[model samples]
Target: MPPSGGSPVEPPSGSEGGVMLSDVMGRDRSINLFAGFLRDIETAFRRLEDSSQNTTVLAPLNSAVEKLPRKPWEDPQDYGALGPNAYEGGEGRERAQQNLRKFVEAHMVPLSPWAEGEKVRPIGGDRELWWEERDGAKLIQPDAIEVVGIAGEVANGQVWIIKGVCHLT
Candidate 1:
């Protein structure tokens, strides 16, 4: 876990031998929307379980997810269709899954202890992201979402609770 001032709480004594990313997010109420989303995406969950690679999860707060202009699975191509259930059946189901995967992956950085200004390709997409500190807050960029604090420090990496949504598709 990060130092106490920038982290919600001190990491549990067993952090190094310890909790997984899923457990961390699942237990944190502030990021339940993202935690729920993580559960629904199996591949993303698998990535979280892969301790061989370092990963940092930039989970958006529930309020941040709620304030999004559109749901995570939505794409403008879906707008070409009629109803809200655009990603509901047949090929749409596959499309929905793909869209959802990208949304979750966008929040995941492939590196842990990610440097403050070093840009890196995300674990799942073409878009690269970096961090910037404006005043005292560390923000993920391209989107400039504010990272509120470290939610958990585990063996694999850290989970950051953020204040804004990332990719929509």
Candidate 2:
């Protein structure tokens, strides 16, 4: 006769009490991608600041620190033609600008990682995301990169986690 207990379950392949590739690639990309996205936002902010003078208040986002090797604006790949919802001409261009603004607003939000204390939450999604603590300091589990630590608040300004590198996403 079969055993009275419930059937045994098999653990996932290549992940036996160890970190999975998904863990390494997934969440890490989110940070990197967001950093890239921030470049455009910063540029837009700079433009606004120039026009508004000192009257406009602009708090710099953490993503501002990221030095993007290449910018999408510089690319002549013709993203407009690539997608079905391409923006062409004056009205289309305006729509595209507005769309970008909305994206920034939704993703670049104020986050207080220090104030909350331990377990930093990701801004991109509802899922709970946090950094593991080690010896009273937060250990940055930056996928395969092995980021030892980072000073200042990791919270704030559109934090997200995605599978694989920014290019893949």
Candidate 3:
């Protein structure tokens, strides 16, 4: 949380800051990996851009992303069913895109200046997320992902650097 009891109002463009999400995240070094991940997923990138200033981006740092068990576009469920050819052809491409989309969506909350206690279902996601302060840290629920800091504030919303990835499925 930026400030305790900060104004929870939603801006018309979903941001009071006069900036774009792409420019903010794309240029920030700490958020580079997450930004590139979104760029690879066309619709997911657009969704975040379209959501600008109005959403919350819980970006994982380079270290956290690099530590993932597999690539963001790779989902175990799909792999189990489709096997090694899961990402081989046109169908594979679509599945990869879908997995990428899910990954990106899980990192975003539909509103900006969100409160700590309110439960929120991320954009294009079914799971609910919420956070609370403990030991001077804002930790998001389920995985207790830590909110490291604010990466950038764009015209659409603020990009929060988080320590862990939330579960998607």
Candidate 4:
């Protein structure tokens, strides 16, 4: 488990080692860090919309903003459709996809129905995810959106990094 700032808080003596203090803190920090990244992504989306130059990479970002089901909720297909067009070359496409995956993962909001008690799965399938709690707040980690060797990256005002990847069901 990663350190969660400041001095480490040693566990109380004589307690069962069911869960480590570091684990809990790491989860909490991961959630907060991801949330901050999501906030930045939302702003980036807005800037993409405001831009006038219509580039290939801008297309997917625009579509994502338009098709985002709701605030903090988005479908993975939106990123898939953008494909290589989201980036300039092979490397660019990979970066774009990585970025988009990061954006969605960071921004993914827990559905009330699912968050109530049930274990939530990824939109497409059983992709491993990270769950974190910070100050009693919960956060979900984003899944990797990739096709082959290409990864996604966030560039400029758009989530313009991707390769023709599929999220296996």
Candidate 5:
């Protein structure tokens, strides 16, 4: 387990001896959107688990999802005549999954024990994110979003539940 600004907590069970991303997000009840995102990328998470390098994930909670620009696939009407579940299989599913993978990757930085005042590039996007401490509160990409609560460590990395989705501008 990673330090949470204090003593380390016990790692959650079923984490393959490493802290899983789902376990970290599970601790925060408000991170439903991020949890869903993780579910959509189960394969990616598995790959992350297999890697030896440490990673840092910047996850957006429910409120952050609400603030983000809506994606066409998120709306049932956007599914056209095929229905919402149309994206569940076939080429559409592949494309949608690819997009989701990119979105999730954009929020992840390949570093562990990320510190304050560090500018890091995301794994899926070109823009750089910085860790900022304002008024004694820790924040990542202060110009883009706010950190909701304390950071938690998982088996391979740290998780920061952020308040808003970040976009590459």
Candidate 6:
């Protein structure tokens, strides 16, 4: 967990040598709300095994969850009350999983080590994302959410911890 009432954690400079995306996300409490998204990313990586295609993950922190619109398939009553695992092993669970996978994929790109100020399209291909650098901090666009940290050297690619959700517009 980050220190209370202080600036967000900054991503380490350069690759830290083969850190899995799951491990990276697990260590950060700020983005714990994105557990569902992280799991979906892991699922995607498993599906694409042995593929050398690197990826850039845009991981949203807890606050971003509040910004996302409720999905039609989601149970409105359980929206914020449920965790990613809550959607497992039940009727419509498969659909929920699929939806989650699509959501995570939409925010990812098949490019690693994405530099600051580079404009690239997400895997979803619905909109473009700009990796803007501001005051030595990296941000992903639509809302200029700062990347608080980064975990590199994962099996598939890298994970970037963004301050908020990247709402598709």
Over all chains combined, what TM-score does candidate 5 have? 0.71
- State each model's CA lDDT, in order: 0.75, 0.31, 0.75, 0.31, 0.64, 0.59
Query: Residue 123 in candidate 4 has what lDDT?
Result: 32
Positional deviation of residue 28's Cα in model 5 after best superposition, in angstroms: 1.8
Q: Cα RMSD for candidate 3?
A: 9.0
Report residue 153 deviation for candidate 1 (angstroms): 0.9
TM-score of 3: 0.83
- Where does candidate 6 stray beyond 4 Å? 1-19, 40-43, 47-51, 66-92, 151-156
CA error at residue 31 for candidate 1, angstroms: 0.9
Q: What TM-score does structure 2 among the candidates reach?
A: 0.29
For candidate 3, write residues 27-140 as lDDT tens digits: 778878778767766655555556433788899988888899988888788889879778876767767777777888889888888898999998867889999999999998
Q: Supply the global lDDT for candidate 1.
A: 0.75
Checking candidate 6 for backbone clashes, the offending pairs are: none
Name the TM-score of candidate 1.
0.82
- Candidate 1 per-residue lDDT, tens place, 4-111, comes to 111122223433345666557677899987876676677677666665667899899999988887777777777777476676656666677677778888888888
User: Candidate 4: where are CA atoms >4 Å away?
Assistant: 1-32, 43-110, 113-117, 123-125, 128-169
In candidate 3, how many Å is residue 120 off?
0.5
Q: Which 10-residue window in model 3 sums to the lowest lDDT?
A: 1-10
User: Of the pair 1 and 5, which is ahead by lDDT?
Assistant: 1
TM-score for each candidate, following the candidate numbering = 0.82, 0.29, 0.83, 0.23, 0.71, 0.63
lDDT of 3 at 119: 95
Candidate 4 lDDT over residue span 12-112, tens digit each: 34323332221221222213332233333433322223323211121122233434453222234534776534344564444544554444443222231
Candidate 1: worst-modelled 10 consecutive residues by lDDT: 1-10
Clashes of 3: 7
Q: Which stretch of 10 consecutive residues in model 2 shows the poorest summed lDDT?
A: 51-60
